[model samples]
Target chain A: MITIKDLRKTYDGFEALKGVSFSIREGEFYGLLGPNGAGKTTTISIMSSILKPDSGEVLLNGKNIYTHSDESKRIMGVVPQEIALYNELTAYENLTFWGGLYAVTPSELKARIDEVLKLFGLYERRNDKVTAYSGGMKRRINIAAALLHRPRILFMDEPTVGIDPQSRNLIFEVIEKLHNEGMTIVYTTHYMEEAERFCDRIGIIDNGQIIAEGTLDELKKNSHARETVVVNFNNLNDALLQKIHSFGSDFKQVDNMIYYYTNNLQTELSKIISQCNDAGGEIHNIEIRKVNLETVFLDLTGKQLRD
Target chain B: MIKLALKDLRLFVKDKRSMLITFAIPIALITLFALAFGGAGNSGKDAKISLQLSDLDHTEASASAIQIFDSLKNVNVLKVTLEQAQEKIKNGDEACVLIIQKGFSDSLTAGKELPLELQYDEAQEMQVGLLQQSLIPTVAMLPFNIGNAKAVMRNRFDNMVKGSDDSVHTQIHKESDGLFDALAMGVMQGSGTADIGAGFFGGDIKMTKLVAAKKDNTLGLVQAVAGTAVMMLLFSVVGIGVGLLDEKQEGTLKRLLYTPMNPINILLGKMLSANVISIFQLIIMFLFAAIAFGLDIYSHLTGLIITILATAYACSAFGVVLASFAKSRQQVQGLSTLIILVMSAIGGSMMPIFFMPSFMQKMAVLSVNYWSIQGFYDVFWRNLPATGGTFLSRIFVLILIGTLLNSLAVMMFKKNILKLS
Candidate 1:
């Protein structure tokens, strides 16, 4: 288990992490969800022993990460957002080099390399230079390198940001398999659905602070954000838009569609239907969404999860 | 299209290291080499070839022969005893020794030549070869001693005619005496008039030029030092190119810190590799120098090793400092090329420091190339003993440079990499 207490970091007088605190269980999947510059990376950097916080204590297992940095880093793996790899080297060579840094025995390293390459489906391209690999393949190899040491806890920062759907799905499968095999993973991503799908518990970070943390259901119970009632009108003319606006300022109109958020969607839906009917526009379709992570993020920060 | 070409040209020029290497280094090298060698090519006018003369023949003819040599532009005739001449050649003080045998003049006049010995240290191959070539034309001038012989013959014929009675032989001898006088006067007076037989009359004089073993010689040491020092700079640059710049740009350098290894160890490991490679470079250069230039590097083995290690340390330190300042491999290449070229030019590696301007010579101390070259020069060129204070001073300065610059580079890297982050 890894624990972070009152993590604070200031960079050039700008606070990147402000008194942020969190913990990861031994075999849990924790997702940190935030937009850009929301301290997700800063928090992960500190947690993975890559960067130090100004005033914080990060304990890996039972040892403080800073005081026992080498021991802490030994059991932790970090897959950076960027592909930190030697392009001139083959995939096997890259894995061997990183493994050597971890002081893996030669025989064990060879076997582990073969195992990891097969796992990542890059065994066939083991002899090819990393520069020859595709973007997703390169990312897979990058993750494979971090796992060479078989770290107890893996810190993956936006591992699937910009890749094809096929590659992304492969990565998701690998993460799920690793989590299933009891590898404690601290996954950071701004993609709402990935967090909702993968994370056993989620932390919503914004403006260098974690504003809320819980499971999907628990967060929904705590958030004041209502279910969204999206209405598709046959005619979303100015008359229908103005009549819908009269219900509340929370209702938004987009071509032939109107969206309204309310604590009670049933009551608000009736009022919206009456207003649209009065404006001479018939409602074609409607969607009532309960409070999701994105809704909670919007409700707390008045911004999109990816904003 | 022309505007696009102009934009590309601007971008190329904006890469300051590349621009400096392309335009500045070559131009500076050319200018400096021209300045250094231009005067060296005309060195014949400034310094004469030193030849020690041991004239065992005490005759007037031998003195005249010596005088003839003194008048020549190529040879500086130093009159020493045979023992002194041998010592001078052994010590490499003189290029060669010329020993005129006891009957050198008599044998020349009698047309029975004796051996004229030319002694030289064989290790001074280039200098000895040049001096031997000059000796041919100078020695060929010996047949002109016939002028002195003719004067002696003419005097004898005059005395014979004065003492004899008026016999048939006396009358014939008297008649021939006028012809003899005319011929004798012609050989003596016209000898100075026509310069046709000027340089090559000493061929009939049998001479043996022997290679003498040198007792304490440091010939070709300067060339060895100069060549080895320049090669060390190249190795340092290559080391930096492959090690620091490549790893940093590849992100492997930063990633190495993620391991259990300390950052200082990583820096030291890179430095150690560079230093070792540079030492090997110096060794290879010196080995070739010893083979080709006939340099006796092994004569002062301890000094050579110390100098090599010191030079490698200093050059490798310079490489580390240069790499620390650069942001990318391209920058390292361009900047190192420019700096190395400039250092080699101002230092004694590209040319002898003496040949450079006084200001450049003074500024040469700022370059590590100068220190290394000067260290080698001190031990080899100046023939200072390897164990002396001067030799120790050179090594000390190099060590100081290595220590200071390496520390500064490490400090700067730490500040920029960790503190800035």
Candidate 2:
């Protein structure tokens, strides 16, 4: 379990984190979803004890992580966005060095290194230098190194940012297995599907603030984001656009397509068609989009999930 | 082609490190070389040769000789006892010692050959030659100062007359000796000989050249090994220390910080690796010197080992300091190259420190190369014992410098590498 309270960090005159706070229960799969430069890495860096917050505290099980850094760090592992590996050294050697830094015994470290390497399906290339590894393999070893010490909590910051789909799926499966085995994980990503599929509880952070936090369904329900009825029209004019705008206040128009948010999609869809026919605008297509995290994110932040 | 050239020029101008290495390093190095070689408007006084003198005779003649040497504008005379002079020569502090033998004044008064002993180290063949030449004018003027110029000339003319076999040569020598006798008589009234040829002291002072004992290696080999080894070791350790920057760039340094270990441990690890590499580099260099150049490494094994260890430690600390001051690997390369080369030039790595100007010699003590090379000189060329005071003092200063630099490096690592600021 971890608790971040009013964490504030500043670089020069720019505030990176402003009164940001969050909490993750033990064995909870918590996902921090945010776009680039949304302070996701900064928050993870503070929690992992790599960066200090100007004003605030990160508590690992009720103990201030900054004050008890060594103790807190011993129970936490961080997989940074960058591939933090030594290109000149083999995967086994990198793991051994990291494990040694954690004060793991030689015999136990050796066993753990082999087990982690195999777990990542990189046992065959353990002796090869990381320079010789593919991008996906390097990413796998990066995660494998963090798991060598087997900390209680794992912080993965966009671990699968750029990799093949196969490697991404494999990473997802391995992370799922780790969660099932009761390891608390704090995952951060801009990918909506990953957060939707893997997170038990999700927090959407933007501009150094967490705007939304809850389960998927709870987020949709709390956000009050209605299902979207999307319709494309030909020969649309300003008159037709004004008429469509009169239907509801929650609407977005781009080019000739309009997205109408309505709780009564069935009734709104028929009325929109009739209005379009009366306005002499030929309808091209019509579809209904169910309310999901993407719509919930857009509804809460007024922007796309990646924006 | 012009566009490509302009593009390259733009890139080069943007890279400050490359610009510094290309322009600044060369200018600094040239200035250092000019200063060392006395080419930058030097008055030649700063290039004085150190001459150690021991007045065993203690006569007025010997005193006059000492005074004349002291008054020379380009020679520094240090009056020491015979034993002290010998010790200085043995410790490589003085290249040669001039001993005024007993009865030197009597011999000069009687116009017999003057008794003088010049004990010198043969290892410094070049300096010994220069010292020998510098001593000639002082020795030639000794007879004039002691009022024995007429007697010395008379003795020399008599030998010439006696050795001549032809009647014509004897007549010519007698007539020339009469002219010199009149001039000596006129000039001798005031105890002054204003002009004398350098050859006048050739046999007048029965000078004995005694080579100092226990020097077997050539000076060139000694200097080359010690100088190249120290300079290269500095470069190598700096190269090794630059790995820290590489780690920082590659994100491994951040990963290491994420661990439970103290951040200082990473710096210490880097220092340890650099020290290890420097030690191996010096060992291989010296071993190669011993094998190829027949250096007497075995006889000075203990002293060599102590010197190498201290030198390696200091150089490693220097490398860490360079790395700490630099923000990237390219910066380290440019900065270290400039500093190390300048240090080497002024510190006797490229040439003997004595060959530099006096001011440069004083500043040489600030460089790691000076202490390291002097330590090696003690072990190889000076033939000093491992426990001798001079050798041990060098080792002490080296270790002290290493400790200070390492402390500074640790603070810099905290500020620069860890961003604790």
Candidate 3:
């Protein structure tokens, strides 16, 4: 369990985090979702006690992490965005070194290294230097290194980025297993689908502030985001686009397809069809989709998840 | 092709490290070499061969010879007692000493062989050669300057003339006395050579050249091994220390800091590793020198071990300081190379300190290589005991230098590398 209270961080004259606070319960999968430069990594860095916030306190299981850093750090592990590993050393050597730093007994460190190596499916290449590993394999080893000491809480910052789909799936499976085994995890990323599928509670942060926080269904209901009606046009032009815009102001365009959001989808769809016919535009297909986290995020911040 | 070449030129100019290495290092080295080779003002006067003179004979003949030897150019004469001279030569302070025996004047007056002695260390063969060449002609002309050789020749000629009643023989003897006087005056006034001819004074003066005995005959080899070992150890430890920067660049240092340990432990660990490597490197270098060059390592084994440990610690600390001051691996490499080379040049690794200007010799104390090489010289060249005052002082200074540098490095490592402040 972790409690971050009124965390404020500044770099030069720019304020990176302004009174940002959040908490994670025991054995809960908490997601900090935001775009790049949206204070997610800064928050995770402060929570992990690597970066000191200007004015704040992070309590790990009711002890100040900054004051009792060694004790707090012993129960926590961080997987940074960068592949923080020594390429000249083998995976086994790197793991052993980290294990030693964590004060793991030598008798137990060996078994832990082998267990994590096999968990990441890198046991066959454990003897080879990390320079000879593939990008995905290196990413796996990066994640595997943090699990050597089996901390109570794990902080993963964008671990699945720039990896193959198979590797991503395997990482998610291991993380999910950890969570199911009552290990608390604080996962930070800009991927909406990962947050939706895996997070028990999601906090949508933007511009150093958490604007929305709840479960998936609770977020959709609280955000008041309407269902989206996707319409494809055979001959979309400027005139037809203007005619469709006149019907509803809440919409996004992608080439010939337009995503229109509204509560009264039937009336808006009929009116768009008649207007397209009159404007000499052909309708290709139309589909009505339920509101998801993407729509909820757009409704809350007026921007895409990646922006 | 021209565009490609221009692009490369642009890149090279943009890189400050490359530009510094290309232009700055050469300029610095040239300036150091010039200073060492007597390019600056009065450097020729400064670079003189030191000679020690011990006059056991208090006679006029020995004084005259010493005065002539002292008046030679490019030689500085120091009058010392025989005991002092022998001690200096034994401790490698003085290369050679010229000793005039007790009956030098008596032997020259009686027309017997001259008693002169040269006690020198064979290790400094070049200096001994200079001493011999300078003293040879001075010794050859000593008879004319002292004992009134012209008068002696005149009296002999007169006696011969009186014995032989022939007028032709008397006149010839008289003319020969006048010629001898003219030659003796010319040699005494130091105006020109007396035309004494080669091999004429070969037996007149008995110059005994004695070499001081030592356990090892190869002092030059010892100097080379010790100087090169210290200088190269500095370089090797610096390379090892720069691994800290490499770790910072690769992000592993941050990962290490994330563990449940004091951040200073990381720096201490790196320093320890560098020290270990430096010790091993020095041992290997000395072992090779002992096997190949016949260096006497067994005689002063304790002193050698102490010097090596202290030197390794100091050099390793120097490496850490360089790494702490630099922000990147490239910066560390460029800065360390320039600094180490300059230190080596001034600290008597590339050349002897006596060859450099007086100011540069004074500045050599600022270098870690200076202390390290001096410590090794104490063990191998001087053959001083490990517990001797001078040798122990050197070891103490090395340890003190290491402690100071380590403190500075720790402060900088926390503030700059770990961003603790």
Candidate 4:
């Protein structure tokens, strides 16, 4: 388990992270979600021991990692956003090299390398230079390198950005498998869908602070606009669409989907039907679904997940 | 640590630029020097000159002067008639002409001489001066020896008792031969004290002539080539280091740094790989020049090895420092080029320390290259002992550079990588 308290990182007079606090329980897969410049990278760097916090205490298993950096680093792993790989080296060679950085013996490293290689599906191209590997293959090796020592907790910042669907799925499967094997993970990403599907819990970070943190259902419950109801009418004209937009503030038309962000799905659905019924527009398919994280984010911050 | 070194070695070897800059170019340069430089030994085998005799004396005595040019080495004897010779002077066929006038022999026999016109192109004064200078020595030898011989023959005939043993000429020949042999042999015996390789023993090595000043002795040339080999070895090592920076910038270093091993191990591995590169470069350059130019590199192979070892350490350490300080591959290149150019310039790689200003020479002494070049000069050119104190001192300087630079590189890398400084 990792515990962060009163964590603050300041450069000059601008604060990157300000008095943030959080904890990741043992064996929990946690996602740190934020937009650009949300201090996700800075926070991760501090946890990885690559940067020191201005005022903070990070405890790993009841031990202050800052004070006992050497011992704390033994079980810690970090996979940076960038592909940290030597292009000239073969996949196996790169893993073996990374394996040596930890306390793994040569025999131990060989076994671990085989396991990770097989898991990442990089076994076939293990002997080929990394320069020849595709973007996804490189990303797999990057993650495999982080798990060389089988750390209790692995920190990966935006691990699946810019990967193809197949490779992305492979990565997602690997993460799920690791989580299932009781390896605690601190995964940071901007992909709302990935966070919604994968994370046991997530911290929605904004402007270097966690604006909200909870399980998927829990965060949605707090966000009053938890359900989105939408309907389309072929008879709806420009004036009527503008009049309907005034009735449902968050309603919008694009293609055939009318997006309605709402707190009460059934009540808002009835309101939409009665208002459009008098306006003489036909009601197309009308259905209700619970709001995901993006709605909670839009409700909380009035901004898109990507921005 | 060993893991890092192996990685560095493997990457460097796979890099084609490392092979090209460090090994191929140096070897090619050595081969060029060997094939281009013709051995400049003056054994009197190939010489050329021309002669124009006026024959004004129309006597055998004056004509005998013409025969002297034939005995000289490489003297192309062109016999030009007086009118032809005069016209040739304007056309510059010969550098100078020896015009023998009428009564020249009579004037000489009368113990006086006529002015022998030396007709040459007035516009080519320097050429005329060279021709005249050469003639002065040759003319002096002929007149002195022939006059002396003729006087002796005349005196012997005047004293001849009709046939007072006509073997007088034979007897006198034997006596003259004995005296000449005694004087020549005495001079030779006096000078025979010089050792065969005295110059190589750090004595008078320069057999430099008035002409061909740039043509160096075979030993000295070999030694200079050895110095060049050491210089380029440093460059190749730095090139290898720059390559390491490329890997680091590409994110390879960060991954490697997180290994369970000590960072020092990684640094040492890189240093060792760089050392290997430098050593390989030196070997190839030396071997190429040694084989192609007939250079005597083996004269002090052990000493050269020691020098190579020292220079390799220094250059490798330098490479580490460069790699550590650089943030990107381009920066690595800029910094290495700047440092190498400065080191090469100050280290007597481009010019011998002997020719540099004293201040510059003192500065060169502060560089690793100076010691390397000095070591090579001593061992290869001077053929000095490997255990000589000078060679040992050079090795010390190189080791010092290695130690200092290696430590500094480690510190810089740690600071920058940790983002502490």
Q: CA lDDT, every prediction?
A: 0.74, 0.84, 0.81, 0.70
For candidate 1, write residues A1-307 as lDDT tens digits.
8888999999999999889998889999999988789999889878867677889889887789888988877888888777878898999999998888886889999999999899888898899999999999988988888888888888898888788887788889889999999999999987888999999999888888989999988888998878887788776777667766665648655466666778777677787667767777888998887788888887777677777
- CAPRI tier of model 3: medium
Best by TM-score: 2
Worst 10 residues of 2 chain A by lDDT: A242-251
Candidate 1 vs candidate 3: the lDDT winner is 3
Give the C-alpha miss distance for residue B326 in model 4, angstroms. 2.8
In order of DockQ, best first, we have 2, 3, 1, 4
| Model 2 lDDT per residue over B202-259, tens place | 5333343344356678788888899889998889899988988888888888898999
Candidate 1, B26-103: lDDT as tens digits: 877677666555443345533456678889988887888889878878666789998987755544344567888887
> Candidate 4's residue-wise lDDT over B1-421, tens digit each?
9999999999989976576567765665454333222223223332244555556667776677667655665454567687777655533234456766676566445333233566654323344554555555555433333334333333334355455565776676676556545644654667432221121111211111222123222534654675577667766777777766765666666655444445566677888899888888877887887778865666567987888788788878888888888766666665566556556666767655433333454577777777777666556544456776655877888899899999898888777766531
Candidate 3 lDDT, tens digit per residue, B1-421? 9999999999999999889889998898888778777885554556677788999999877888788777878677899999999877765567778888899888778645568787876655566776667667666666666664544454445655666667766676678678877765766777655346113443233333344245464657766987899889989999988999888887888788778888889899999999999999988998888888877787778998898999999999999989998888888888888899999989878776656666787788888877877777667656667887777878898999999999999999988743632
Pick out the ten consecutive residues of candidate 4 chain B with the lowest summed lDDT: B199-208
Residue A209, candidate 3: Cα error in Å is: 3.5
For model 3 the TM-score comes to 0.84
Label model 4 with its docking quality class.
acceptable
Q: Candidate 4 at residue A167, lDDT?
A: 88
Candidate 3 residue-wise lDDT, A1-307, digit = tens: 7888999988887788888888889999998987778889889878878788899889988999999999989989888788988888998998888888887899899999999888888899999999999888899999998988998999998889889988888898889988989989899877888988889999988888888888998999899788887778898889888876776557788678877778887687776567667767787998877799888887787677788
| Weakest 10 consecutive residues of candidate 1 chain B by summed lDDT | B193-202
Q: Chain B TM-score of model 4, please?
A: 0.49
> Between 1 and 2, whose lDDT is larger?
2
List DockQ for all candidates. Answer: 0.36, 0.60, 0.57, 0.26
